[model samples]
Target: MRPFEFHRPTSLDEALALLARPDARALAGGTTLVDLMKLGVEAPGLVVDIGRLPLAGITLESGSLRIGALARNSAVARDSVVLSQFPALSEALLSGASGQIRNAASMGGNLMQRTRCAYFRSHDWPCNKRVPGSGCPAREGANAHHAVLGTSDHCIAVSPSDVAVALLALDASVAIAGPRGVRHVAIADFYRLPGDTPVIETVVQPGELIVHLDVPATALATRSGYLKLRGRASYEFASASVAAAVKLEGGVVAEVAVAIGGLGTVPWRDRGAERLLIGEALGDAAVDRFCDALLAPARPTPDNRYKLDLARGAVHHMLARSRPC
Candidate 1:
């Protein structure tokens, strides 16, 4: 790791001032940041610790759930209301990392975690995301875990956040504070696809602090679950995952929200699939159609062709299991 100075700011203003500097980065849970630093993927001159700020509480409003950015992953996952109402979010959080990591990983840090692309991590490889215009190694290199959608000629790395996927399905919005003052960004718009600049994973302005995420109140969101298919049962990343939130009224689907993970540069949302089941019964054919629509436009590489079928199976499984909800 490179030598760097650290400052644990007690107030939001102090942290914001430090972050305004060119080479300073916020340090949240440090679960993702520390790993990237060790791999030499990120080397900021100053680590402005924002974990000390008073941004670690969860509030249940009249309708929505307001989650502080610094709220621990375990805290949110274990909340009775979250577990009962937002099972998908709980499942996603429980499916990631480990118990210790879940305890240490904050809500904001998990959303801001870096990609898991090998070429991006290996300094020996030529990656444009690592070094601008250096060229991409994953294009013709080992890419079993790379993205299948929203990829660009410059990069094909996928966002590695299960929680973000769940939040996308829930139609959440993030509150951000920057030099320009506080603003809100829809969670879907918060993450950016790898177009020309793969290095910039999010739409967040520079020096912006993620204050909190607002999970909207919806019957669909309350009846959701996340399903992940990995190589192992624990401590593993998703090979393909599906997040589904469905609300049924009078034995028919009333509303649905679908987002996919482990297969895209950003949390993949399928509006067509969501529409297929919105006003119909979620039968096997409806489920299959939903699955097909979700994977129809998928563009997978030779190394990860199985991800398409894996994603299909995951979608089917999640829908089938969610029926009793």
Candidate 2:
């Protein structure tokens, strides 16, 4: 890794001041940023340590779930309140990295995690996301894990956050603090598609630091689960994963939310599928239609075309498992 000045700030104001400098990056848990630096994918001149700041609380005020950015992934997954209120979120966290990693990775660091695309990581490859205008070799290269939805000609790398998929299904929002001020951005709008400018990944500004995550409680949260299909049972990223939350009233669907990861450029949420399942019985026809709603617009590459079928079965199975019959 390149040599860089490290500054540990105790207060938010002091951290923001350090981040104001050019090529200055915030270091929360050092889970993702540190790896990228070692790979030479990212190199910042100044690293502002935000781990000492008091932002590691997990609160459930009224009905909403409030998670501090510094909260560890394992703590959130093992929290009794989170397990009872948002099982899908807990499941997604556990489905990801090993227990050791979960103990060290922070919620904010997970949000800022980069894609696991092979081309993007290898400095030898011509990846548009790694180096703008270099051209994306993944568009025609070995793309067995590339995205099928929300992809642009410039890039097709999939988003690699398992917990973020569950968060999106819960309609979560993030509280961001920057030089301008503090503002809450909905999770749906946080990620940007790999458009012509694949370099710009998210809505987060240069100096903005994610302070907290806001997940509003709903009946859907009580009846939810996450399913991940990977090459192995553990310590592997999902080839196609589904986070499903469904609420049924009198054997009929009342509310539903579903999001898929490892199948899109971002944590993919299909409101159309949610709308189609509302007020309808969970029958084969309804389930088929729901799958169609989610996978109709998918345009997969030749190598990863099986992801379409895997996603369909994952959606069907996740909803079936979430049923409180």
Best by TM-score: 2
What is candidate 1's CA lDDT for residue 42?
91
Clashing pairs in 2: none
Steric overlap count per candidate: 0, 0
Tens digit of per-residue lDDT, candidate 2, span 226-297 = 999999997988899998888788888888899999999999998977799988988878989988988887
The candidate that wins on lDDT is 2
Worst lDDT run of 10 residues, candidate 1, spans 316-325
- lDDT per model, in order? 0.87, 0.90
Compared with the true structure, what per-residue lDDT tens digits does model 1 show for residues 77-98?
9999888888889999999999
* lDDT, candidate 2, at 318: 81
Q: Over all chains combined, what TM-score does candidate 1 have?
A: 0.96
Error of 1 at 168 (Å): 0.6
